[model samples]
Target: MNDVATPHDSTALVTGANKGIGKETARQLADAGLIVHVGSRDPERGRRAVEEIGGRARLLVLDVTDPESIAAAAHQVGDLDILVNNAGIMAEDAPAPESDLDAFRRTYETNVFGVVAVTNAFLPALRRSPRPRIVNISSGTGSLAWSTDPERAFAFSRGAGAAYRSSKTALNALTVYYAQALESAGFKVNALAPGLRRTDLNERATSADGDPAEAAAGAVRLALLPDDAPTGGFFSWDGTTVPW
Candidate 1:
């Protein structure tokens, strides 16, 4: 029996819910008794996911990179309490000098700009709620502290993942800005480093990369944070604070 009653008649939308972490996040949120909108760029895929979830999960066709798609999806979501910006891409893991401008454009189009577009479009619906929450699926690579630390393993390649890494950092900035802007209105906006889960974002991520559900739990926690919870914070899947 799903007994967790989310606060304030909470309703949510999880983007990129067709597969991987996004799908898992939707499942958990629905399990928590919230009406979850499974946002996907493809209607068929979204339908499949909604079938898989088999709860209060609705299908929403949203392509974050497209203005029309974002606007249309927002129009349908009349009252939303949670917004999970989980759609992202890693075009190429090339170093700064070796990276193509087009690749960076593609990465930022989804990872950075997409979040802003979706958030702005949903602001009206979110504002109608008594307690609104926004969770950005960011990465640890975005943390300047970890990036600059010479001791970190990934620090070995100072120039690796120029496109994807920087996009996440930019996402982190947006999280902070959104949190500050919406805090007064009872909105909790935060970024999460779900870790390098075993997803299709890259060729190397396989089953060994880790379970996507593990990371998705973090999104749910952020979405359900209490009224006194801190906003504009970066947190790990384990609920520990991540340095910005």
Candidate 2:
């Protein structure tokens, strides 16, 4: 009795898909009929996630910070239509003027460098797809416009997490560059802020308002964007454009 025609023979790769927002995104995409590659640094964890997802879900052992791992993953999962750069980390203890330089370096290594590495490694596969899409899981903390405005939501709390915030800002910049470069090829590269949800990344600081699926809404929408969808934009969970 299943009647919905699945969206082509497209495949999606979601990095850090073993848990949290990435996992939710994978589930949504798989439900939408896209073959989803759940990328995790740990193969066991990736396998577990794939098993939990049940259908059209495969494991991809990928450590974004490791060039060899990225290259190997690229080779294994060819012909990708979507790439979700959701792997990121923050030095929870480090903040502001006293933030540890080593911590900042580590954060950048994963958040910034890792993204660029994964994106480049997957470029060939992405280029081959009819409607290539890249979604970077960004945050409001990275919004330069909001962080600087005293009346804005995150302004008061912007003093902390320099490493994480700046890394996402750099990620936003990367999105713009990639979008511009891939425009002629019909690729859509955009950044999305999943909002502060209850997740391991945030140490579950907040209560689960509902389900983790709530946070993945924006990313899911961006991942399955239409041909005419705008590229190089930052959007919130409800689809409102975020200022740079």
Candidate 3:
């Protein structure tokens, strides 16, 4: 990994930042003058994204699924002002109910467990910052109340992906638990649903009028929240609070 000094006193980390909403979040953060670390499992892609952002953007090789990589990235980052848990995977296809449990396990390995690993690993660095924030890139699909609604649009498309949706639900729980634990410690931890952005995760162009940049805005807002902002809450791209 290529290690470099942070250009600003406030540093932010965005996992899966090589592309999609993650990349857009990194770019916007960097543009706003934060020292942004674009985390990617692939070193080449991470470096290229940092270069493209063209500011205080740096590269950190982080594969949330790997413990070694997570630890190494935490050590490399030293101190951080923001942590965006944006890396996640969706199953390639819906598996039979009795089919391989391995597929569901693997999805959780990255979506749920990875968040725990990365957040714990980076806690020390986050605590060091005067204004620390943790934003989990969650989904509207994770909302049991919404996902089960017959009239909800996402419910129609998200019904088949049990592994992915369940993993995110677990992630939402994680966000609240951590937020409570860190509430007195002065860190704002929250989850954000980027809406349906056209990204590789869905294998389709983001729905009409969907912009990854628009989705990233919510994450950026949380990452840059004032010290008095609310914690342990779920929010949407437009800043509306979501049910836990």
Best by lDDT: 1
State every prediction's TM-score relative to the real structure. Answer: 0.96, 0.94, 0.92
User: Which regions in candidate 3 have their CA more than 4 angstroms from the true location?
Assistant: 1-8, 93-99, 155-158, 205-209
lDDT of 1 by residue, 1-244 (tens): 1122255457999999999999999999998888999999999999999999997999999999999999999999888999999999999989999999999999999999999999999999999988888999999988888988899866887769989999999999999999999889999899999988999988766555589999999888988887878889999988899998
List model 3 lDDT by residue over 7-53, tens digit each: 36688999999999999999999988888999999999998998999
Per-candidate alpha-carbon RMSD to the true structure: 2.5, 3.1, 4.9
User: Candidate order by lDDT, highest to lowest?
Assistant: 1, 2, 3
Q: Model 2 clash pairs? A: none
* Weakest lDDT window of 10 consecutive positions for candidate 2: 1-10
lDDT of each: 0.91, 0.87, 0.86
Greater-TM-score candidate between 2 and 3: 2
Residues 42-149 of candidate 2: C-alpha lDDT, one tens digit per residue: 999988999999899999999999999998999998689999999999866445787888889899999999999999999999999888889999988899998999
What is the lDDT for 174 in model 3? 93
Note the clash tally of each candidate.
Answer: 0, 0, 1
